[model samples]
Target: MEQIVGSGKFTYDVNENWAHVPPGIEMKPAAVAVDSRDRVFCFNRSNEHPVLIFDSNGDFLMSWGAGMFRYPHAIRFDAQDRVWLTDEHHQQFMQFTSDGKLLRTIGEKGHRSETGVPEDDFSSQAWRQVTHGGGPFNLPTDIVVVPNGDMYMTDGYGNARVHKFSADGRHQFSWGEPGTGPGQFNLPHGIWYDRRGRLLVADRENNRVQVFDLDGNLLTIWPTELIGPAFFYVDDEDTVYIPEHNAGMFSIVTLDGERLARWGAPIHKSIHGVWGDSRRNIYVVQPGEWGRVRRIVKYTRR
Candidate 1:
């Protein structure tokens, strides 16, 4: 596979491919997280089973989590190397060992029976009908960990807020509401805690990034002109890489929202997710008409 770097428009590398399609499984790859060993874990929304795993070379290693997961949207690795996943459809969060052992599960599932159900009503019929809950999470899109081991999750989409949890998956506190206010969110999709402990959230529909303190206090907003800035990552040098799902490309920006590099052509529409490995190789999830494909492209500093 050929590698491309620097800031010129490029076509999707049809040669450099890394994907794992296990038997009886469909690949609706939504998120990718690489462990310390360079092993890639891809989470899909196609089935309620164990997420898919692939080696650095994209070879199928193993699979786990059968009979578990409702609508797994995001996969993340903590400092301790533990694996965490958020199920937006069922309003639940789960923790697992790097090898896929179920460590713990958070939030409740089931249907709502009445109107005006409280946001935390885990079993209300209304809860089942809507995506955001005033409680645990109506549809958690992403998760991140602070330096202190506390976790921050974007309880976005159906619900417009972010929830904080202890390392043990215990709910600590949450912030944000359904509005355009500074503290409120429209669709808080992805989240990350920068090296400075400043919370960075991908306010997708709002076309901006919302900064906050560890306590959920609104700090400021950075406008990103890209349509649907769904997910992003902040590198060691504070370079922010945001994948624009609607635009079919990714932008490398600074903390102040300056575009550094842009890649991908219009043919690669729906670039839903992005991740970089220790080798500075950027992996993107491109879901197109046929199916979802994972492309691993290497980049270098200019």
Candidate 2:
């Protein structure tokens, strides 16, 4: 029999063979997103097929995005079912149609923000200094689109700030700096905008999730001892999914910060991202380790 995991309403039966890929097709999944039809979109690190699509039953449907991304980091679907992708290597995030057509782009391609370090400073000290000097974006991470079409993104890789942008990609305001304080963040990696319009930020290095209002004001803080929380996802009922990268597990939490259930151990290759479908089935993406390729595990809620 398959192993069961989680507790109470979140209990699930693990399905290891959820996604069957063709042999020789290597996948280094950076992020995962579900569309309106419940189709799974695996954003990977392959120049040939950067986007891999699968039905909810784990059947491979199709693939696209050849020569479209330098580095695929995160994928998100907005209210209109438009796909948003963050390419850290290109230092930009873009919106696209469900069929894989590029609709818009939001940053200078390959242009990184200045870190205020000396030209001769190539040592570790210089690297630390550059990270401390918060700028527009050193390597921006995830993005959250609001109901009104506004957007918020975390400058995570080399900075610790979140910038807000208008629907058309105009900078409205920005907030944060590198620290462990309430409003501060150290590698604010993942972000999500809940139905109530509250912003949830997975402050990875700080070991906490910070909540904020639409105006970028600090509202509350949800702390976790889990190693690295790479991303955040909330179901329709407001259940939050926190994927801990290093600890090799994820906790299902309430909006009030209560951890209701936890799952994943064998799929721990490296939990980079996660999302759920309308049927409450959870999907976890492991970018794979050593020489292995990426894989997505599905857990059907019981």
Give TM-scores for every candidate, taking all chains together and pairing residue i with residue i: 0.83, 0.91
**How high a TM-score does candidate 2 get?**
0.91
Regions of model 2 farther than 4 Å from truth: 116-130, 266-269, 287-292
lDDT of each: 0.70, 0.80
Clashing pairs in 2: 27-294
| lDDT by residue for model 1 (152-239), tens | 8887656677889897778889877666667777777889888776888887767778889998887878765766687877766777
Provide the lDDT at 34 for model 2: 95
In model 1, pairs of residues that clash are: 50-64, 50-65, 111-124, 112-124, 112-125, 113-125, 119-134, 119-135, 132-158, 132-159
* After superposition, candidate 1 runs with Cα above 4 Å error: 1-16, 20-24, 111-133, 265-267, 289-302
Error of 1 at 187 (Å): 1.1
Instruction: Tell me how many residue pairs clash in candidate 1.
Output: 10
**Which 10-residue span in candidate 2 carries the lowest summed lDDT?**
119-128
